[model samples]
Target: MKSHLPEKIYLASPVWLQNVLVSTYGAFEHRRRYSGPHKKYVEYLRKNVFLNKTEIADLQSKLLERTLKHAAQTVPAYQALNLGPTPKLTDFPLLERESIAMNAEAFLSSKYKKEKLITLFTGGSSASPLKIYISEEARQKSYSFWQLFYDRMDFHVGDRKATLVGRKIQEPDSNNPPFWRYNLKDRQLLFSSYHLSEKNVAAYLKKLNSFQPKIIEGYPLSIYRLADQIIQNSIKLSFTPTGVSTSSENFTQKQREIIEEAFGCKVFDQYGSAESVVFASECEHGNMHIEPEYGVLEVLTNEGKIESEGSGELIATSLLNEAMPLIRYRIGDLGEITESNCPCGRASKILTELYGKVGAVIINEGRQAPTAAIAIAFEYLEGIKNAQIIQNEPGKVTVRLVKRTNFDSKSEEFMIWELKKMLGQSLKISIDYVTEIPPEHNGKYCMVVQNYYKFTVPD
Candidate 1:
């Protein structure tokens, strides 16, 4: 295991500082025997989080006899290694993040405590920031999902993934090369989500045109925006991307449609967490599937059952990443089950409709989608580099534009009429002119946020 002292959890610098995150975990040791009450807790967790009734029953029978035996032989926190004359497993106790943050050194396994281990930190947007402590074995096993999932999609790690994000805003200069790639188990090219301007996009496009990656991943809206530019420039998206993926935020159908036109590829939406846990992933058939191999999905319903589709809470219990197991963890996202199965041969569960990420559903009024008439009208506008329309409330909308100063009132009138012809007369438009738009709460910029969407956490 690696030390947090040399990590970048504490600063904005190239290095990770230890203080930014601290979470104590149940400690383990190699070449050790457990003799205390470890069996009881492990059995309870296995039954509640990992097994079904039959499996639990079968496990219980074995556990009935070996609970003491297993604990005495394996778990370190136990009191007696083999019920020895005097054991102190009770002294260690159940581990947690708080304790780890207090004493990181004592928890490390003696075998590899001095070895070099790759490290990482959590984004902390879901609940609270956590300092993740892992071993080379832990890191590889914990992060093996994407690699396997992609291989399932027939794409290899050496291929490039198109990333559309809205994090850092970088103004162009030859000093820092606009493109960067890293060896994160697989190859990657880091592009700036901050510089998607008309000129910047054209330049970004030219660069991508040369790199010619085989896949795309990142923000949905940014990819959609790039698609708008591609259409305007008469750019051919015939480049065969193995697949297009999106995450870190909610994806609107409108944005997905745009990405399809721009990338000329199917979009795969993946849902995950810093817990290094897998939630759900989209299949080739445009259907989202859960990797139950990694965790169990529990949909908590309300009293109504009236709004029926099993919509309420999405709670999950991870299956594989056991370095630190989270039991019945609340994801805080609202969703429902879809009875339909994908034409693809994937054997996984499905969800019907998903309202954006975590508490985003809100009541509001605003322009919805462009009618076939508006899409037709877009053909007439000139100097129109790219655009995004967000309905804030019942009668208000925000328009993000990247165009030349030559856009006069006459042009505005034409654009307004086209919008009116499409969204109908009930909605009003609010144009916010800025060099570029910034990402929302997370590092992702969702194209649409229900004008007044509000989410409440239960007390």
Candidate 2:
């Protein structure tokens, strides 16, 4: 969010020039992520996966000690705690998002200057974005985990990949054909989630056939919409990926089924946060395994007691990021960690179930829509600060929005039009422009709140 091109400049550039800019940015990212320590880190993870339970625990303890020592010595926020020469993870109090946002500078290490670190802004979940900083080494280490996961799925970095995530390659309101851009350096084709309507999907499919990417990675709902269309029309894809990978949103079994059926391959769903504190990837055996090498994950109950094998909120400590080290940070997501071991021969912990932002389903009469679909409705819309969708009854919905000073009738009209294209014409949609959309009781934002069940029972 912090490093994106200005809207005026992006719109003013010609299509070819836009591709050039995208490729150039992609090349920079490729060099930053894949150089130096990346390969070594990936190799370490490859062998670390097979480590036994006791071995992993020992590795995590050492990593935790190192991270805590670095933070207590260098970070001003942790220094105030007076954590002694040897302190446990719980010695530091649980960190809240407000604590980070209010004193962001205080959290930074004294050794690193703000201008020197790579600053990243988280998107899609909160009304206010949280800025996180890290060194290039930490950034590359974080990316290595993802590359290792992709390797498990038979896809590697620099391979031809078609990404259906939220990238503003094209205008939100445009109805034209090319709703995607090519990053030649990374061998990636970035597609805009805004223009994935029925009218434009054929063109998208045509392009996919020609590009023939080996792997497709994106939000599950965005990919699901394409798979749903393929199934509905009984259309066969001209190409098949080695496998499909999904992240950035909660994935459902139904969505996985449709995607796999359409693509004729397995669907691997991975869970991670932009905060870089925790990561979990699905194995070929279809189990979600939490890599102990990345960080220490603790599932805790409402009373702050750790849950050994059941459902609770996830608390994690990052072993990677020292620039702004977060120890025992409340990740604001819920999940069930089971004691059951994965048959895939990995000793990493298994997450039996995980939920982020609830992934609530909005029902319009008989048709159901995921929250990710609703969020994509506002993609590339410049004037919108935040938006939320609420469905109280079937076939009726209300959208609450926080708009910027430049928000106009055109922005609202395009949003409504996009919503209609996805939900249906029968969906009675209403827009309410407000100052802010507050977070829920758990301090996390829900993109879609479904009260349809409270209003009436299903058929």
Give me the candidate number with maximum lDDT. Answer: 2
Give the count of colliding residue pairs in each prediction. Answer: 23, 0
Model 2 lDDT, residue 62, Cα? 96
Backbone clashes, candidate 2: 0
lDDT of 1 by residue, 1-459 (tens): 122232223223331111112111101221011223233433433233324435544543443233333333343433232465333323222333334333334333333433464334442222112344444454444434555446445675456655554322122221233533332323455565434445556666776777788887776655665777886678864366767777766656766776776777788887776554445777677777665445655555665222213665555544543333333444445567544436775535576556434213212232123111122223334334334455555656666665545566776666665454434445567776556645454333333445553322212
- Residue 205 lDDT in candidate 2: 84
TM-score for model 1?
A: 0.53
TM-score of each: 0.53, 0.84
Best by TM-score: 2
**What would you estimate as the lDDT of candidate 1?**
0.47
Instruction: Give all candidate RMSDs, comma-separated.
Output: 16.8, 5.3
